[model samples]
Target: MPIRLTILIVAGSALAGCSWAPPVQESRTGQIITAPANPSGVQRGPHGETSPVLLTARKMIGVDYAYGGHSPETGFDCSGLVYYAHKVNGIQVPRTAAAQFRFADPVPRDALRPGDLMFFRTSGRKISHVGIYLGPGRFVHAPGTGKHVTVADHRSTYWRARFAGAGRVKTNYPLRTSAVRNPR
Candidate 1:
C-alpha cells in the first residue's frame, strides 16, 4: 500500500474513535414523559397519563387558602397556588394573578389545555381571580380566605360569568425522555 494512503487510513480510524457521542437522555421543561399512577384510580379528563404540571397542581388540592400566603406549609393564595404549581415544575411565573395573566401568552378558551392559567373577575374587577386548568372543564384554585384549595367545574355560573381570559406558560421541556438525548 502507498505510505500516504496508509497514513490517511490510520488518521481516519483515529478520528472515528475520538468522535464524541451525545448524552443518552435529555432534560426539558414541561415535558410530560411519565405516567403517574392516577390518584383517583379512575379514568377522568383526557386519556393517557396526566402532565407533570397538572399532577403537581393535583397534589396541592386540599391545601388551605391563606391571605397573601405563598408557601405550601402556610397555605396558598390564588396567585401563590399558581406560583407554587409552576415553580414545582421548574417554570418561573409572576407572583400576582393579574401579573401572571399579563405575563403569559393569551390562550383562547376553546384552545384551553391542562396546566394553563385561567383568569377571572371575582370582585367584579378585571383579572382578579386565577386558577390552574385541570382539563375536562375543571380547574384547581384557592377560592378565598377560609376556603381550602379545591377543583371546580369551569362551567359553574360563578366562574362562567366572572371568566376574564386564559393564558399559557410555555417551556422548553420535551414530551418524552425515553427517547430524549439526555434525561437530566
Candidate 2:
C-alpha cells in the first residue's frame, strides 16, 4: 500500500472509538469527517431557532399556566415547557429551573445561540425561571400564574434585571416510540 493509504487507515482507526468525534466517512478518495445532522432537521450552527425543541415550545404559546404541569392538555409552567420540549426532541433535562441550570453547560450571555437556555432569578432565588432563547435577544417561555407561554425580549427591563445566565443542552440519541419490550 502507498504511504498515504497506510497513514489514512491508521488515522481512521484512531478516531473510530471516540464517541464525541464527528462522523468519519470514507469518500472515493479518502476519509472525511463531518458534523452529524440533527435528527429533527434543524440546521446546526447559527440557525438554531428552527430546532425541534424551539418548535415544540412555540406550539405551546397561549397555553394556560399551570404550576407543575408538563403537557399541553394540562398547560405548563416555565420549567415544564422546557422539559416537555426537550423530552419530545430526545434531550433529557431536569424538571425544574434550578436543576436544569445546575446541569447545563453554561454559556455566556454574549454568546447565547437560539436554543440555549435563558435562566432568570424571578423568585428571588438563584435560578427560578427558564426560557428557550429565540435569537435576537428574544426568548419563549411560560410566564407565571395567570400568564400564558409567550415570547419576550430579554433586553426588556423586567427580564434584563432577572437574567441570571444561559446554557446549552447536548442531544441524546433519538428516542424509540415503541414501549414494548423485546425478549430477544
Candidate 3:
C-alpha cells in the first residue's frame, strides 16, 4: 500500500542518516514531502511566520492608543508601536513616523514581505503614519487618537488612497567593541 511505501521511505532515509536534513511533511496520499526553498528570501520563523518584530506588534493588538506613548503600559501611537517592537527585538529604529520612514530602506509595494514597514500619508503632504506589514495586503498599526492598535487592510479605500510606500529596516548594525586601555 502507499502507506507502507511512505513509511519505508521515511525509515530508509532515517537509517541512511538523513536526520540532519530539513524537516519533511506528509501529503494527503501518505507520501513524504519536503517544502521547497523560499524564493523571496525573507527570513521567517520556524512555522514560516513573520519575524519577531512583527510578532511583537501582533502582541500589541487591542492596546489603547496614546500620543507620544512608548509601551503597552503607557499605551502606544503608530510609530511608538513600531519603535517598541523593533527595539524589543534588538533592532533600533527612529521614534516617529516620518523619521522611521526616512530611515528605512525603500521597498517596492509588489515585493513587500512580512515585517516590512508600511507608510501612509494620512494627513497633509508628509508621511504621518506607519504600520508593520503582515503580508497579503494586511498590516498592524495604532490608528489615530481614539483607536487602539489593530490590523488593517491596505486594499480598503481609505488606506489605499493614502498608501505612501513600503520600507525595510536594516538589521545589521556594527557591534561595539570595547577599547583596551594602554598601561603606559
Candidate 4:
C-alpha cells in the first residue's frame, strides 16, 4: 500500500500546475503529499533522492582533494566543490566559503531543502567550510587536504556545533531592465 502511494506521488508530483496553487498531491488512500521545492528537473541532484545539484555532488564522491582546485581531474577543495557543482548548473557561487555564504538568501534550519548550501565555522567565528545539503540531515562535501569528497551528517556533534547557517541559491539571477542599455 505504501509502495503504491509512493508511486502515485512520484508520478503526480511531476505535473504540479498553477502558480497560486500549492504543490499538494493526493495519494491513493487520500493522503496529502507536499510537492518538492524546485521540481524543475534532475539538473539539481540525486533523482528520487534529492536535488540534482546534490546528485552532481554525489558523483564527485572519492574525488581527491587539492588546494584551490575546482575540477574532477585536478580534485577539489571545499568551496571548489561547490563552485564546480553550482557553476555547472549555471549558478554563480563565489569560490570561497565566506563568499559562498553570501551568495544566497538566508534559510533557517527548519526550512532547509535539497540544493541548499550549508555553511560552517569549523575553525573560528567566521564561515570556513561549506557543503551541499541533500536533506534528511545529510550533505555532500569535500572535507579537506588529502581527503576525498564524501557525505557527512549535518546534525552530528562536529558539524552541528560549527553550523553557521544555510542558504538557498537562485540558479537564475533576476535581470534588471535598467541594466540594459537602450540602443537608441
Candidate 5:
C-alpha cells in the first residue's frame, strides 16, 4: 500500500472509533457510579439550595451536644439540630423531636429520602432522638453528651433496633392548585 493511503486509512479509523463510543447513563441509586448530564442538578453539596441543609448539618459535626442548645457556634442537641437545620433552610419546624415528628408526613423506612427526619426512642419514654437521613441507609445526628454530631449507618445495631419512624416536612409550595378568573 502507498504511504499516503495508509495514513488516510489510519486517520479515518480513529474518527470512526470516536463516533462509535457509547452514551453515558447515570445511576440514581446503588454503588455503580455514573455521572449525570446535568451535574448541577444531582451532585451532592452546598451549591444547590435543596441539599444545602444537609451540608450545613454536616459542617456541625464534632460540635458538642449541649442540651437545649440551638446555635451552631455553641452546640446542639437532637431536636436543636433538627430545628436549626430546617429554620436555616427557610422551613418552619417544631423545636422538639416529638413535635417535629408530628407535623410532617410519615415516610416508610424503605422510602426515606435525604433531609427526612428519623426518630428513635433512646430513653424508652418518647421520641427522644432524631437524625437526618442521608440516603443509602445513613443518617446524621447529635447522639448525646460526650458525643458530637456525626453520620452513622442506619442499619447499625444501635439505630436499627431503636428506629421509631420517619417524617417529611411539607414545603410551602402546594402539590396542586385550582385556577381562578380575574375580575375586570
Candidate 6:
C-alpha cells in the first residue's frame, strides 16, 4: 500500500474507539487548539443589535413552535426563531438551518460568545436544528411543533449527541453605544 494511504489507515484506527472529543477546548498545556476568528474578517460587533435580537427572542419564550412560523402571532420553528430575532433587529439571515449553516462563519464550540449560533443534526446528516447561544452553555430555540420556545442545556445528552459546530454571525448586533445619559 502507498505510504499516505497506510498512514491514513493507522490514524483512523487510533481514533476508531472514541467518538467525540469536543469541538474545541483548552489544552492541559494551557493552549487553545481551535480559536479561529470570524471568517468574515470583520471584528466590530452589535452592528446588528445583539441585545434586541436576544430581547426579541426572550419575549418569544412561550411562543409555539410552528413549522413555517415567523412572527409572534404565528410562532416559530428553529431557524424561524433565528430568522425572526435577526430580522426584527434589522439584520437578515437565511430562513432554514441548512442554509444558515452554509452562510455563517463556522466557530469552535469553546470559542462561542453570546449571540453566536449553535447548530445540530437532529434528524439526518444535514444540519437541521438551530439555536442562539446565551452564554454559560445555554441556548434558546423553538424545539418543534407543539413545543414552545424554551431554554435548553447545550451540554445535555440529547443535545451533545446531536451537537453540530457553532457559527458566528457577522451582524451589527446588540447595538453598542459610547454615550450614557444621566437620569433627570
Using all chains and alpha carbons, the TM-scores for the candidates as numbered come to 0.68, 0.68, 0.69, 0.68, 0.67, 0.66
Name the runs in model 1 displaced over 4 angstroms: 1-49, 173-184
Candidate 2 Cα errors over 4 Å, as ranges: 1-49, 173-184
Question: Residue by residue across 48-160, what tens digits does model 1's lDDT show?
Answer: 64557666666666667898877667778999988887777787777888788777778889888777889998875757888988776789899998898778888989889
Q: Which candidate is the best by TM-score?
A: 3
| Index of the highest-lDDT prediction | 3
- Could you report the Cα RMSD, in angstroms, for every candidate shown? 21.1, 17.9, 15.0, 12.3, 17.8, 18.5
Q: Report lDDT per candidate.
A: 0.71, 0.75, 0.78, 0.73, 0.70, 0.73
TM-score, candidate number 4 = 0.68
- lDDT per residue (tens digit) for residues 1-184 in model 2: 4554355445544543342345467778796757664433223555344667887786666677899999777879999999999998877788888888876778999887778899999867578999998767679899989998878889999999998888888665434222222111
Clashing pairs in model 5, backbone N/Cα/C closer than 3 A: none
Q: 1 or 5, which is superior by lDDT? A: 1
The residue-by-residue lDDT of candidate 6 on 1-184, one tens digit each, is: 4554355445544543253243478899999887543321112244533455665675567667899898766779999999899888777788888777876778889888777889999998878999988766688899997888888889999999998778876765434222222211
Off by over 4 Å in 6: 1-50, 172-184
Please give the distance, in angstroms, between residue 152's alpha carbon in candidate 3 and its true position after superposition: 0.6
TM-score: model 1 vs. ground truth:
0.68
How well does candidate 3 match the true structure, expressed as C-alpha RMSD?
15.0
- Which parts of model 5 have CA positions greater than 4 angstroms off? 1-50, 173-184
Tens digit of per-residue lDDT, candidate 4, span 16-44: 22322436989999999986665433223
Instruction: Point out the higher-scoring one by lDDT: 1 or 4.
Output: 4
